[model samples]
Target: MTDTTARTIPIEAFGPGAQSVDVPVLDSHLHHVEAGEGDPIVFLHGSPTSSYLYRHLFGLLAGRGRLIAPDLIGFGDSGRPEIAYDLADHERYLDAWFEALDLRDVTLVLQDYGAAFGVSWASRHADRVKAVLLAEPVIRDIESSALPEAFVGAQRVIRTPGDGEKFVVEDNLFLTAVLPGAFLTPLAEADLAVYQAPFPTPESRTHLIRFPRNLPIDGDPASSVEYLARNEAWLASSTDVPKTLLTYEPGFLVTPTIVEWIRENVANLEVHAGGAGVHFVQEEQPQGIADAVVALLARAEAR
Candidate 1:
């Protein structure tokens, strides 16, 4: 059901020591890129991108620990099933990925939609998680009033019935616009193409389209709301597990209002300014992100 042949993404796209491992997850195979070895540092990328997103950090942190980055089901080169690409759908396959790889004592690096699934897993399996590194993460349901006007307008267009599909699928806004626009420094055509490669066809962009649509707007997508509530409880309760929140300027999900909210709500959370980026902190501040993870790993070991 899976290929162990390990297709290699060009180092040109991701940097040196990049290779793919196809593992049987759930009903199909999942493609993940990995490098180095030690305590596993699993990088979970958010919407509209794949394992390739962490190409820079994978080698940078090789001296510290194993770096494993997976393309969520229906994203990147991972298996694409004809299921509704909702939060539950992503989490179900991701749980299988964890089991398949037998990952434990995980240092989860989360961003964007990846936060939704990764945080939910870490909260439930707090015993398995060693630490968490978050950047521009979507930790809870969106508070529209706290959001930037531009972002709100964009969301409105994307969530609109006919417009959503045209923009996300047909026009391929996620890769064409959203991904490119997130970075503080613009991505080169070659580097940007790597992220764009996965969803070349509109039909292949099922997850990209659904990710925004499934966001917990006005308490809609009842399941995601319930999931975030549980995640919030776990975040507040799990003080034993270390949590690092890396912040950046002009961030979308981790905005100023959300930062204040996180301070009051999440327990045992240490927030550090990660320079500047809009949403894709990994794209803009890989070094800062890597340093934070290294520090968290050191702290975890010391404790």
Candidate 2:
């Protein structure tokens, strides 16, 4: 059902490595990237993707602030824990990882599933979060299709009886099939290499296959649904968290109506639109996103 031919993302093509280290998790080394100086900005990525998502951001902001992007337990160079991976898994990982580094006064930047981890983590430590920037995070329901239309049937397909692995396929419809011309900007060949590096083998994609099992839309996608329920309640009551909606060229999957709905709603939300791409903004416009994050931080400071 999968290919074992380890696909290589030519290492030379990637941007410079800012800083690299590993978190101790048994025999596995959780690869992490640290760059920049001053206040720390810990980035959390979602399923099937790793710190590779922030290669450009890392390069752009490495001199401005300390950037720490890690490969979650089941993805990238991290140890595949052989356990089910989901939001709760990410929450625990973020809790422990940040604690290990003693990260404080963070400007947590998140996107996609990263939103779930970063937001949930920030809500737990409101005093630590200075500001936030999100690219179609997993804040609301998946069907909302506000961030990326890649949401709708992807989860539905994978959660089926035997189609679990389909969602994590190397040539994922989300990226190759659906994302082709839709994502904000086409990913640079170098950047695309990073996102494509983790799943070198079909069998190594166990996490990818299982990632779909964690979607909370269904009855109980993963164990974190309960935590997500709690996080939603927190998002509703908490007014201290400064959040922004950075919109790019999204596809029909995420109709303008859905994104507009968020633009109209959500308190303390600043929505900016001026680019194009189906979903992955970090890929197409890395510098733009980096600037936007810095700008949002300034806005939060002014208020």
Using TM-score as the measure, which candidate wins?
1
List lDDT for all candidates, in order. 0.80, 0.63
| Candidate 1: segments with Cα more than 4 A from true spot | 1-16, 217-220
Model 2 poorest ten-residue lDDT run: 1-10
Q: Which regions of candidate 2 deviate over 4 angstroms?
A: 1-17, 25-29, 144-155, 166-191, 216-226, 251-265
lDDT of candidate 1 over 1-303, digit per residue (tens): 343553334544555665677888778777888777788889998877788778889767877777888988887778887788788888999999898888899999999888888998997787899988889887777778767776677789998888988888889886788778766689888778877887778777756877877777557678778878888888888787778898888677775767888888887789999987788778788899989998998878877
- Per-candidate TM-scores read 0.93, 0.80
Each candidate structure's count of clashing pairs: 0, 13
Output the lDDT of residue 44, model 1.
91
- Per-residue error for 144 in candidate 2, Å, reads 6.8
Residue 270 CA error for candidate 2 (Å)? Answer: 1.4
